[model samples]
Target: MITDVEWATFVPSALLLAATPGANQLLTLRNGLRHGLAPAVSASLGRFSAFALMVIAVAAGLGAVLAASEVAFNVIKWCGVAYLLWLGARTVLAAVRGQVAGEMQKTADEGDGKGVRGGLSSWRLGWQEFLVAATNPKALILFAVFLPQFLPRGAKDVAVPLLVLGAAYIRIEFCCACGYAALGSRLQSMGISLRARRWLDALTGVAMLGLAGWLATENH
Candidate 1:
């Protein structure tokens, strides 16, 4: 029952929000550098799994009710917007600090060490990814939109079918996030200078802030 446009609307925003290179992405990058590709991939996978599970659980319990209420939707949307803005601010601050710290590491690695660390720490990355996804109210709202569109009205058993769709969506999303993470790791490996990494962080922060501003100004 989900229309193509609705499905279209769901994927880009959800993936962008999830894949945004901020704390979680940075952590994934760090993990990759510290551990390896396998751990990095696992972290991304775990994080997405968390999102999928949350969407399903929330949908089974409150998806229909929230979908029916415009007021509740507004509340959740504003909360998500605020959170994004906060995250953006933090990213900017982190970038500034990273610039200074990275310089020291650069000197150390160039002089004393053979090379910068390689690979990701799987457990750490996975836990960090899960936390980021779990705490995101916007993620919850995104699912609120997704599940109802796919569900048949007055379905006798909402739970079973909802879970199935949730699993499917999660699989799609997990693959997407992993793809993005892999790309990011490769980019990081391409001798991303400290200056460049800081600049990328700045850009990501700006994008998030702009998105938050747009969300705040939005009527719906």
Candidate 2:
């Protein structure tokens, strides 16, 4: 069982990490702007689910294999980098063609009656977020290092403690995602012009591309 002091220390650290504007947060913001709050929250849940799985893998000792194997690490890293680049390119192209802004307005004018057809389906968004979080080698490594530190001293079973801590971390991430998505939704409701929407798309695209570059350059 985690002590009170450990819980106090861990909760703040986890929330601080979750609140950082990383790929997950960026994707949530983009989804909120394009599809609305529900889909964004779905995506966030998917991401947290992925993180939970990673924690399980670490507790099961598979994380060591991934960390030590260059082939496994590079494969996952490149996949994440490729996906980020593809998403960025797609967003930039949509912005340039003015499809993003036009479609958003059309959906609004049409009362969003078409639901998933009006934009990305929530299921697809969730799956995409899952893939992004699952394939992130950096996250795997971070979990491998970070989860163990919070383990209770001389614990008989490591897995349970790791799992408990992981759940706490996921909770923090979910709350942060909610706040960020809500902020994004509020901005979307401000009647941003088409030009501004286009600009937002372009900026999101740039950020995605930058993250891809950072991931690509990261050493193991």
Candidate 3:
């Protein structure tokens, strides 16, 4: 069990880590700003789901295997880079062509569409968020490497400790996501213009590109 002292240290650190602006947070923010709170919140479930899987993987010791294998790590890293690059490029192109109005209309239509189309849109959003969270090697590293430091001294079996820490992190992250979603949803009432929307997309694209570049430089 984690000590009260440990909890004291961990909570603040966890909050800081969860609040750090990363690709996942950026995605949530964009989703919130673009699609409104409900859809964005729904989409963020994908991210949380991915984190849950990773925590389970860590507890199961797969995280250690992934951490140790350079080949495996590199494979996942490259895939992330590729996906971020492709996604970022698409958004950048849309912004460059001044297609925000058409793109937003299409997204709104898909999000608001009935039955199959709406389901597909929700699934796609969730899947995208999932991929972004899952593909990042840093997440696994968080479990395999960073998390163990918080474990009880001389503790042999790490599963429970990992799960505890993972749960706390996920909980904090969800709160942060909701906060971001609410802020973005508020913009809906303010009636942001298409030009501003284009700039936002462009900004997000550039940030994604930066994150891809950063991920490409990560080492085991």
Model 1 lDDT, residue 109, Cα:
52
List runs of model 3 lying over 4 Å from the truth: 2-5, 103-117
Quote the positional error of residue 126 for candidate 1 in Å: 5.7
Considering TM-score, where higher is better, how would the candidates rank from best to worst?
2, 3, 1
lDDT for model 1 comes to 0.59
Writing each residue's lDDT as its tens digit, candidate 1 over 9-102 gives 5456556655555445654554444333455667776667777677666756765566566787677667656766776787678778785336
lDDT, model 3: 0.80
lDDT tens digits by residue: candidate 3, 1-88? 6552277778888888888888888887777767777877888999999999999999999998998899999999999999899888
Indicate the residue-level lDDT of 130 in model 3: 97
- Candidate 2 colliding pairs: none
TM-score to native of every candidate shown? 0.63, 0.92, 0.89
All candidates: CA RMSD (Å): 6.1, 2.2, 2.8
Q: Residue 100 in model 3: shift from native, Å?
A: 2.8
Report residue 134 deviation for candidate 2 (angstroms): 1.4
